[model samples]
Target chain A: MGFLSEDAVATFVDVLVRLVETAGAVIIFSGCVIAFVRFLVLAVRERRVSSFTRVRLDLGRMLALGLEFQLASDVLRTAVAPTLREIAELAAVAAIRTALNFFLAREIREEREEIARDTAERDTAQRDTAQAAG
Target chain B: MTDAVRDVVALGVVAAGLLSGAAVALVTRAPLAGLQWLLDFLLAAGLLRLGATGTPTALATAAAIVAVRQVAGLGLRRARAALAVPAPEPPAPSP
Candidate 1:
């Protein structure tokens, strides 16, 4: 019945937990917004033309990378806090995520190069075929 | 020591060791793609560290700076190549 009741302390802790959760969410949201803006700026600077098809590809890749970045940041902040055990767990997760990104980036670059090479070969083949037909 | 400093030093040593190994591999004409794996690990650690600290805006800004540096480097190389090459004559018209 006193001011020092256990219930009061429990309620206070609950409120503190909620505040921390809310702050974490806000951090992630702000990260996403920043990523979107950066994407827009890069697209413009790159002089990218916006065909529906091309735009879709560009947005997908950029957003995927951005979100990956955001997640990576979240995992990092986990370790930075005072929970040593949680830090170890999160560090493992971060390592896996990084490996995934590395492989994905390499695949993307390789595919892009392959596509360019194929396009050039196809063009040469078409020209040869057209010349023979004529 | 701070995690950041520890990571940087670790990565630097790894990079240096890999470079030396790569040089040895080059002499032996062996594949050296494993160096790239180390780089990938460092990149992941760096991105996570960046994410842990400041706001998303700061991370985005850093990413933008990296992209700009890459584009500028490419453009410079292209311009240099252009200057080095003679312009090709117009294709001869079909007889």
Candidate 2:
């Protein structure tokens, strides 16, 4: 192959940066979409419709963590070179966020189930007591 | 301003919106069933834009992002409910 000129090198670097930015954005968007779908399904099944209060608290904490991770990634991506460094940061951030979502989902599910069961038991006890008195 | 300062400014703006969203969710008891992902996406976009160039525009952009997310989340939750499948029952234990 012929030697590349300085102008060609600059053009190539610009295109590469654009490509990285596009890819990173797409990855983040798609991953978040999937996580959201999962959250919706889990929340419905868990019957946490009345427990938004708890989730709101959880979200506040989660948002803080998510923000810290995302900001750190942005800082690294902007401050570092070599391109791949930014990609690595993106991957790491996505993975961490996904893991956190999963953990939160599981916790919500367990707590909701416990609440449902307790409500059910209390209702059943009330019914039995009324029947005995009658 | 330097890139570092710009990044910090952006982060602060995005953080403020995020905190506001979280506060709204907590205080208003809005549904969280499908908002987490939307919020995360908004937060990410906000951080990216605000961090890139420090400006008042960044604050407006972040607010718009969160607003869009709130709308999308309501639609997503409804759609999800309509499309839900019945979960299978667990096997019964031995007597």
Candidate 3:
């Protein structure tokens, strides 16, 4: 309807941005906590880099998700642009986040490749052992 | 409200980073690994701070944190690779 005013819409966007950013922070925090626990457990039980890699991989995924959410919030923050300064700030923030996101993605890809290579090596070793034993 | 939440989260993040970093260092016995983990958590904290404050200074700080993390992470990866044991060579063929 025509009932909503411009300030009202701006306020709504502000609220939405805050909600989105908070949600992103919560996701990142919980992911970090989970990864920390996993790291502790793996450290105690296996003490191997392989196990830690999986934990890091999962953590990286979570961070990437959280970063995207925050980036969305950043875009939303300027959805109803008010001033030139605000737009410039948004651009600066977005640029930094985009760069960080790129690196996070690359690290995740590297970890996934490492996990795949490990699995292949393990499977080959198992098959050879089975054949030698039979 | 955001300020309070930011403070609490920042404290929690630092603590988590330290605890996990120590655990990793103990398990791997590698200072580089621990430092890398610590920086990742700190970067998360910086991001959170930026979200809450949305100020230019906060943005700059976040950017700095990310920069340090990338540089440190790369160094740690190289150091670990260098320190890694080489894969065992295949058995020699029959003469």
Candidate 4:
């Protein structure tokens, strides 16, 4: 049996990084498409623009997840950065992506909280009405 | 540390973040605020460590991101709140 060479290992890592990057891009694209379709369906059925909030939250969550993958790719690229210039470029890219991820995550959290609160209030109102009738 | 090992560690940190985010998203009813806090700390620590030992640039980048995100989040929340509020009613017609 032949053993793998050091060059082969390096090549494998390179391939893996590229694959991860591609996967991240694909996730963002697919997630956005799915969210848009869902939003359209709900809006058409409900005839209310406010229905978009739910879909927007869902999409934001997906985008945040995709941003994680992108940041990972950026970190992986640092491994091969031989020059200061390349490293600087990676830093800039990472900074922008991370900032985007942070806001996206925060937005998703706030939206989720709002939705939960609305549900709780509605449940309480219904319970009160039932008690009054009884 | 060798570049390979460093890369592996960075990848692991990111993978953990992804998993934690997914977990938070899936469990709807429970308040997983603690998990969210933990995730933020973990990512911050990981990035800082990488920057300190392997690349200082990573730390700077992460710090800038954190600052920008905080400001942006505040602005967005304010905008959304404003939109949620109804406009003032028009004055009653004078006889």
Q: Backbone collision count in every prediction?
A: 0, 0, 0, 0
Give a tens-digit lDDT track for model 3, residues B1-95. Answer: 37778868877987998888878877887677677778778877777776766567767876787788888888877776777768789999989
Cα TM-score per model: 0.33, 0.33, 0.86, 0.57
Ten-residue stretch with the least lDDT total in model 3 chain B: B46-55
Give the better candidate number (1 or 4) by lDDT. Answer: 4
Error of 1 at B48 (Å): 17
Which tens-of-lDDT digit does each residue in A1-134 have in candidate 4? Answer: 13366566557766766666656655654554565466446534653323445665665676677678778878887766768977786787688677667666766787789888877988999999999999
Model 1 DockQ (Cα-based): 0.03
Q: Rank all candidate structures by their DockQ, best first, as comma-separated numbers.
A: 3, 2, 4, 1
Candidate 3 Cα misplacement greater than 4 A, ranges: B82-95
- TM-score for model 1? 0.33
What digit string (tens of lDDT, one per residue) describes model 2 on residues A1-134? 23476566656655554454444433443444444444445444654434433443344344444444444444444433457744564454445445444544554465466457767988999999999999
lDDT of 1 at A22: 37
Candidate topping TM-score: 3
- What's the CA error at residue A111 for candidate 3, in Å? 1.0
Model 4, which residues run further than 4 Å from truth?
Answer: A1-11, A48-50, B1-76, B83-95
Give lDDT per model, in order. 0.43, 0.48, 0.82, 0.57
Candidate 1 segments exceeding 4 Å error: A1-64, A75-80, B1-95
Docking class of 3: medium
